[model samples]
Target: MKYNMLLIIFPLVMVGCSFSTSTESLTDEIITPDIEKIEDVGSEMITHHHMYDNMDRGNHDYVDKTLVIDPNESEIFRGDVVFFINEDGEKDLSRVVALPNETIKISNSQIFINDKKLDTFYGKAHRVGLDKDSYFKMMDKEGNDYDKEVMKKVFDYNLKEKKLAENEYYVISDDWLRGNMKVLNRETVIGKVIGYTK
Candidate 1:
């Protein structure tokens, strides 16, 4: 009777172990891809080839870097690098400098948001002051003689205060000297650049 009981109990335990192993493997198989799919949604990898410099050094060279974009973001914050459609109906990228309904002004190569000076690193970093050589070169290119007053005006040019609409954003490239500031509507924004491949 004891041998018969041992045989029944041992088989039952073995069966339980085998069933658990199979269930674990099945669960892994079913859940792993779902997690991967969830992670992949709204994320895309693209090779950026534009000369936009809002997210990089101010060099206006051709780019072939791969950037990871996340289109799932619903809220856009200042200083976020975003991909969007420009007013010219072209895809472009820029950094958000001012949000909706805010007043933005570029005064003497400085940024003012809501009448307050934007005390940020990018705001300070991208302001390229004109050296004498660069100023002379610019004047030469324009077929004009170099003048200190003209050079100062180049650096001191200001954008008049503009208040954005509720669905508008003021975006600028990192190379503030050469980048154009554009007011984009919310519908034109495609996504936020989340990462890049070095």
Candidate 2:
């Protein structure tokens, strides 16, 4: 009986010692955050939005699985992540390009966030007049000289059409090479993308 008791006690003591050693080792080691790893995590999380300007017609949605932003929030702090969905109900990741009362327009082959060309590397390429003029002529409904070449551009503005109120904003895809557009209002917006899948 005593031998069995000692056997059990020996194991208990050994376990206790092992736990102590593990604890000490953990305390002695320093744990640091990896910036590169964090960036990789952010990329996997779909925190940023994406738009295509060159070929794909901007209909392909890259599904993201993080963040849902509220448009009515009184104060939007920095580092807030947001997302936009493709009009075809496809999921693509996008950051909030404009806040409330901001106007997004496409004139040249670039995007103007609040009347200024936003300096961004979010698009694949720049195809001028990809489909802008055709979309304009189609939306005009007045037969305002929609050209045949313009019809080849296959994107229509896919964001929201609702008027932006005092504190509301709008966003658009970067595929408006030829003037075709899709608008995004705050209400229609999906949550801001906080992460993306690889």
Candidate 3:
């Protein structure tokens, strides 16, 4: 009787182990492919020119960089680097500064939203105009010293308060000195930058 009982228990234990291993293998196979499919469908890798370089000045000279874009992003928030089609039928990227139906203005080299100072690290650092020496150099380079008054306007550049439409957003390049500001409709925005590849 003892020998018979041992034989039965050994086979039962072996079968249990085999069943557990098979189950784990099946689960891994199902989960791994699903995760891969999600990644492939949810994000895309694209080469983008780093034209809006407000966060860093060194990358302003039109360097082509790889960016991971999430095209399904539905909610766009302030400070998000977004990809959109410009008025000229070109793909472009900019940082969102004002949301829908909000008033935005650049006054005295500062950004104000709804009569309040924009409270972001980049908001305070928005470069507006060149310094006196740099401005003079630019004037000389262009061979137009007579436009000194016109060039001095860069030092205290200001934009009148403009209210956005219900589906419009105020976007600007990271380098404010470039003076690239546009009101983008919601439909024009394609995606937001999720990450970068070196």
Per-model tally of clashing residue pairs: 1, 31, 1
What's the distance in Å from true for residue 154, model 1? 5.2
Compare candidates 1 and 2 on TM-score and give the better one: 1
The residue-by-residue lDDT of candidate 3 on 1-198, one tens digit each, is 999999999999999887753221101111110101123423344545454444343333233455556787799988777887888898877778889999888876567777667655445333323444665776689896465565456446689999999999988765555545779899988888765543
Error of 1 at 15 (Å): 89
In order, what lDDT does every prediction score?
Answer: 0.63, 0.40, 0.63
TM-scores, in order shown? 0.60, 0.35, 0.60
Which 10 successive residues of model 2 have the least lDDT summed? 25-34
Question: Between candidates 1 and 2, which one is better according to lDDT?
Answer: 1
Among residues 3 or more apart in sequence or in different chains, the pairs in candidate 1 whose N, CA or C atoms overlap within 3 Å are 54-174
Candidate 3, residue 154: Cα displacement in angstroms equals: 3.7
TM-score, model 2 to reference? 0.35
lDDT of 2 by residue, 1-198 (tens): 999999999999998887753221101122111111123443223344334322123333232222333433434421233344556776543334455666555433444544444444322123232344545555567666655455443333223223345645444333334322344445555554333333
**Stretches of model 3 off by over 4 angstroms after superposition:** 1-56, 59-62, 124-152
lDDT of 1 by residue, 1-198 (tens): 999999999999998887653221101111110001123423245434454444445232223445556787899988777888777888788778889999887877667787677766445324233343665676678897545574466457688999999999988766555565789889988887765543
Tell me the deviation in Å of residue 148 in model 3: 8.5
Give all candidate RMSDs, comma-separated: 23.2, 24.1, 22.7
lDDT at position 160, candidate 2: 28
Give the Å error, residue 172, model 1. 0.9
